[model samples]
Structure formats: structure tokens, C-alpha cells
Target: MRQPSRQGVEQALDRVMRVVTRTPLLPMGHGGAQAWIKAESLQRGGAFKLRGAYNRMVQIAPEDRPRGVVAFSSGNHAQGVARAARLLEMPAIIVMPADAPAVKLAGTRALGAEIVTYDRATESREAIAADLAARRGAVLVPSFDDVDVVEGQGTAGLEIAAALGHVPARVIVPCGGGGLAAGIALALPDAEIVVVEPEGWDDMRRSLELGHIVEVPADAPPTACDALQSRRVADITFGALHAAGARGVAVSEAEIRAAMRFAFAHGLVVEPGGAVALAAWLAGRLTDDGAETVIVCSGSNIDPAAFAAVLQEEK
Candidate 1:
């Protein structure tokens, strides 16, 4: 069977629109240049992950649905997959890092997914998820590397272009596994793509520099946001980034906290990982290249305590 394409991603915008909210494209007037933000944090389950999760879930073979589904996520992906599976009435087993945010861990459970937590500093979530799939006979849904997932994520780009009514000169996306940025880059080849990462979780940055996916240490002297916790780079996203001539930037955790405070002051609620792109903008990471810019506002599943603690620590 033929795989889904860019056109399919476009059509899915309409299909998903019925279930998922058509998040707004608002201007980042605070930052110079015509920066429009794709507020994906407003999606169901508090992140854009739901878009791909539902798009991919709704298309699963009916015969294959009974075997159930399995996935590994740090936070947003787990919640998105769990929520999508619940809607389909399929059993879901989600593997998460033991250090996953309380909000994400609880959110996935609330969505009725069975929880399997592993050591983040030592264990491999891939191995855990793979084993879960083998034992349960479930389909493993990779957070960002699968075509279905990538196609689903591309819908964000489609909507951004449509909403903006024209292609932008540049687009900024926060990178964890690089799926979101890759999806946008794939869909909008006409635009320049830059990835903003928490200073330490710069996997894509280091990966592109090395010309291959390389593992980056998580606690290698940690700073910056939560939810940017990723250890591997994905081929699915790397291909898109390379094709789009993408660049990378790193933002300090202090800068991210300042940006986060600015967002909250402006009535925007964004998690640390999701706020990296905006944080990059606030830190003056881009030039006014006459390119209409769009930043992916990806998620908002915040742990109440961490939120308060970060605010206090930053203060």
C-alpha cells in the first residue's frame, strides 16, 4: 500500500480540525520581525503531539487495533498517544522516563494508558517500549520517527501556512527528537528552519554538526527547561532537517526562564521545552531577513510545583 504524503497531511488538517482545535497563529510583536506563533500548546492534551497521535491512530487497520498500541514519551507524546488510544477504545501501554514530569505522567494515566516507567539516566526507553510491544503484541508508535507520525506532525506546517496566507521566510521550532521541526521543514521547504534547544539537550544541533545521529548526555550539567529531555536523534526528522537547510541555536536555561516569564505575563502558558523557540526569539537568535517567521508553540503540560519552583529559582 502507498504511504501517506504531503497532500494527505493537508487533508488531515480538515479531518483533525473536527476533533483537534485549530490553534491560533498570533504575532510575536514583542520580538522584531513578523513573527507569527503557531499556538500548538492549545491542542488537546495540552500539546501538538495530539495532532499526530490522532491522525495516526484514526488510520490504524481495524484488524490491527485489537492487538493494542504501545509508545514511549517523555511527556506530551505519552499523553497524546494515550488520549488517542482511549478515543479509539484500544488498550495503550505507555513507557515513560522515571524522571518524566508529574503533569505528563499523570496526564497519560488519566487518559487510561497503562504506565511503565524506566530509568532516564541509565535505561533505554526504546528497549523498554520494544519489549512491551513484543510481549503484548501491540503496535509500537514511535514519538516522532514514523512516517505516519511525521505526516501527522506536518499538519502543523500546513495549518501555519494556510493561516498565515503565505510562506514565511523563517520558522523556529523547539527540538526534542526533532520530529516537530522536521515535519514543518518537510512541509515548508520554501522557508528557513531553525531549531531552538535547551542548552544541554541539543541532540539535533550536535547531530547535524556531526553529520549523524549521536547521543547527547541528559544531565551533562543540566540547565534550562523540562520536556526537552531526549537522548537520541531520529532519521525520520534528520532527513527533513537536512533537506530544508536547517540551522540550530541553543538557549540558556536562564534565558528560557526569562522568556517563560514573559509568556506568562502576556497570558501565554508554555512549558520549558515548548518555550525554547520563543525563548530563542527573545534572546535575539534570529535576524529580520524579511522572512515572515512562525514559531511552533508546541505544548503546555506543566507540573504545578516545578512551575512554581522554576519561577522561584529564576527569581
Candidate 2:
């Protein structure tokens, strides 16, 4: 797989920033380290997924646009793809886990995308989506595996670097399939990249350590981070992250909940998956290396009741 480059990222920024918001960088002090939170939680579709989805959609051949596109995501990418397809006046079909958050499912439907639900524990969303696309003559869009998607995600790094006026010493990103982290690593070659994940679904962390792809344990406990529940990391994304010498960390559910509460205290609405980077930092899992750090608060697509319950938990 070809590693995403800064040039590709620059092009992606040129294409994506025109449609997506340049999400803000909020300054803060975290664990005695000077930090900035890249608030992608406020992005279109309530996550950073829109950048890649739109980037890919806009480039599809005019003839291919009639055939439409297909994708699989728990929620964020589903919304991203759905919203992008809606904007492009193209049909979109999303294969989602039946157990996905209600807000995500409804959001995808609201955007006029056809939804197909499968058993997360017993069925493969990728296989189902691929089959659907093949049958319909539609383009299959991988959430984090494709070159265009990765480059689009890299635009976030471009925005971050431009805002900071330089590549920060460290970039902490929440990882599911590794696209965002991989893209950031490519975009900011001089910075240390740290990918954070929920404990039970830390395949990306293990994959980075083992120097190979590793699937999440089949019996892994249910997690609130539906967006970060990728069973395995893709070769393209893992390759970029590996080449960048990126590091990884996993945080417990308790830590994730705490991070959500912390975000709430800061007047930010962050989904569980999106809070992993902050969770890792708050739990002391990441070393305070005195680097000017940017923590990617990746998304905010939680159901209101679910988010409220999480916030009500006592520390």
C-alpha cells in the first residue's frame, strides 16, 4: 500500500476545506503539559469523517456517480458518507451494526441514505457492504483503508499545523481503523503521533506494536465507543503509522467516561470513541514529554440520554 504523502494531504486540504469546517484548536493545560484540543467533535456529521467522505465522493467519475456508493461504519463515517452522497445527489447505502447508537442510526437515515443492519458479533459489515456494492454496481468506500479517504483525513493535520504555525511536538489522535492517525503522521512528519483506543478494542495499538495487523479479540467486552470498534486495522493505514514510528495507547472504559465528563466540564460534547485520546492523557497513560501537544477530540455523536448518563457517573 502506498503511504499517504504531505503533497496528497495538501491537495486534500484544498479540496476538503472548501466544504468542511476548519475545526477550531482550543488551548488548554493538560496533565501539566501545554495542550490544544482539535475540536473535530464539532465537524460536519459530528465527526472528522466528512472530510474523507466528501473528498472521495467529489472525485468519483461522472458516469460512476449514477451507480452510487456503499460503505460500512458504526455511525460517524456512515453520517459522513451519507451527508456527502446527499450533497452530491448520489445514492448511498450504509451497512451498520444493529447495535449502533440510536443517534447514529437515525442520523444516517435522516440524511437519505439506505441503511442495512447486521449483527456485529456474528456478521461482517465489510463483507455485507462489499456484496451490496458489487450487486448494485456501486463503488465501495472503505472507512479508513482507501488512499483518497486517508488523504482527506490528513487535511485535519494541515489545519492543525497551519493553526499552530508549525507542526506541534506531539499529536494525539483517537484511532479506530488508524486512518486519521496515519494521515496526521503523513501530514506532520516531524511530530510524534500517538494513537489512542478503547481498551477492549485496541487492535490498532497491538497492530502497531506487533508490526502486523491484529484483530480485536472476538470476545472483547462491549464498549460505548461504537465508532472505534473496528475489528482490525487496514494495511494502508497501519503501514503509514508504522513508517511514521507512531506510538499507541489504550484506555479503560472508566477513563473514557471520565474523559467525556471532562469534555462536558469544558463545554464540549464528546462521544466515547472521540474521548479516547483525552482519556489516555488524563489517565497518565501518555508520558508528559513537555511537548506542545494537540489532542484530537475526534467526534460528538452520542445519544442525549446516553451522554447524560455517562456524565452523571460519580468520579
Candidate 3:
């Protein structure tokens, strides 16, 4: 039940810097309002997940590292952990949804991690991962539930602050299990934190509005954002975001698609989930009051065919 702190994020930044690349903060403008995009879509492992994944695994004791690690992610976290484990020379077993995007599945596999497919609807990935870890005597690394992971994810926020040479007035982030959003909240205590999610899957939005954690509906509609389909928000993430006075918003599918197109137009490839924050901004769901803002472009792991179809729609 340890809470992530700014100090921990700083330490994590120092540790992850050895492996995590410093992605660019691209300048962008829309409707006369200006913002910076933290293109984590260019990060190693194609997302910011590597920062947390590496920070968590690198802390494992030498005696325990040999047993390897077990984790469950829709896709991004799987690749992150797999890449980190590969760097650390430790084995990784990822429990992934059977229907995860082929690009993500292939990416994790290519990184040399063993994948265990699961039925996301009828089965519990957490249970599968826990049992797998217990049976194999491996460590369990929850995507957003671990303090180390949250702290590690905060490194991006630290970089944002450092690059801007001052704290931004606001930061917009895509929320899955709320890991990245919560991490940024801890990193930029004075900044306004805005968490965005796909419409039907905005449990975190409802949770913050209700002042309690809530589960995604059993009948939530399908979304292209496989990476943001987390069923529930973790206490660790919820606590940090709630304490930071963070607010949440949900964007429509059309908005997400539009944001992806916007990123592409800007010469960046952003997956649907990664574009939700930009979606919110572009759709004017959040007011652009001229304050300095940073919109996080979190990932870019879309399947080529699917991405092509999306692009074709614009043509």
C-alpha cells in the first residue's frame, strides 16, 4: 500500500534513463491555442510503459531475478515488461487478451517473452497471472498497481517539466488503469491533471466524479483502444489521482479517430488509446484557456491494416 512520491519518481528517472529513451515534446497548435505533445509513441517498446516496467524489474534482488517475472497487460505493458526483462536477462511471461492487436502480440513475442493468451471477457487476467507466478515461483508485476511502476511512469512528467523549464499549467493524459495519469499527478503536483478515456470505458472518469473506484460495465462496447480496456482502476493509481484533484473526461470513438489522424498529420503515429487526450483537446471537451498544456501521445502500436483503414477514411 505504499504511495508513489516525487522523490521516488526522480529516483526512477535516474534508473530508467539508462534504458528509456527521451522522447520529444513537439510543439502544436489548434484553434489558436498552443500545446506540447509528449510523443511517448516514439518511446522504446513504442510507449511509456517501459519506464515503469524497467524500474520495477531492475529493483528485484539478484537472488530472486533468476525466477523471472510474470505480468498481465492488454498489450503495451506486456511489451514493456518483455523488453525490460530482456534487457535484465530475466524471463517474462505475459498474460494477454487473446484478441489483443496483432501488432502488440507480435511485438511482445518478438521481444522473446512467452505469452499466455486469455479470454478477456470470461476470464480474469490477474488471477491467471497470480497463479502463474505462484506456480513458477516468479514475481508478479501488476501494470499499474505497483508503486514502483507508478513512480517509473512519472519519469515522463519529470521530463515534461524539465523541458518546459517550468511546471505546465495543465497536462492531459490517456487513462487505462490510471497508471500514467496518476504518475504525472505525483510528478507535477501544481499542475491540473486531466484523464481521458474512451466513452463506454470511462470508469475512471465516473470514479473520480463519484469519489470512489468503479468497474467498467460488464457489457462495455468494443473499442479500438485495446491498451485502455482495463476493467477496474487500482487503489494505488486512484489514490494518487484523487489526491491530486484530477478530473476526467470521456471521448467518443470518432474523436479518438480524429486525434489519431491529427497525430498522423503531425508526422506521428498514435494508437487510438494514446490519442484520447489529444482527442479531448481537439474536440474542445476541455477548455483551452491559453495556459501552458502538455498532451501525452502515449503509444503507437496499431496494426498496419487497421491503421491504413483509419487513414483511408480521411481520404
lDDT by residue (tens digit), candidate 3, 64-177: 988999999989999999999999999999999999999999999999999999998899999999999999999999999999999999999999999999999999999999
Q: How far is candidate 2 from the true structure (C-alpha RMSD, Å)?
A: 1.1
lDDT of each: 0.82, 0.92, 0.95
Better of 1 and 2 by lDDT: 2
Backbone clashes in model 3: 0
- Reference-based TM-score of each model: 0.93, 0.98, 0.99
**Top candidate, metric lDDT:** 3
lDDT score of residue 144 within candidate 3: 96
lDDT of 3: 0.95
TM-score head-to-head 1 vs 2, winner: 2
Candidate 2 vs candidate 3: which has greater TM-score?
3
Question: Candidate 1: lDDT of 81?
Answer: 93
lDDT of 1 at 126: 91
Q: Write the per-residue lDDT of candidate 2 for residues 2-110, one digit (tens) a residue.
A: 5678898898888887789899999877555668999999998899999999888899998889899999999999999999999899999999989889999999999
Which structure among the candidates has the greatest TM-score?
A: 3
Error of 1 at 124 (Å): 1.4
* Residue pairs with backbone overlap in model 2: none
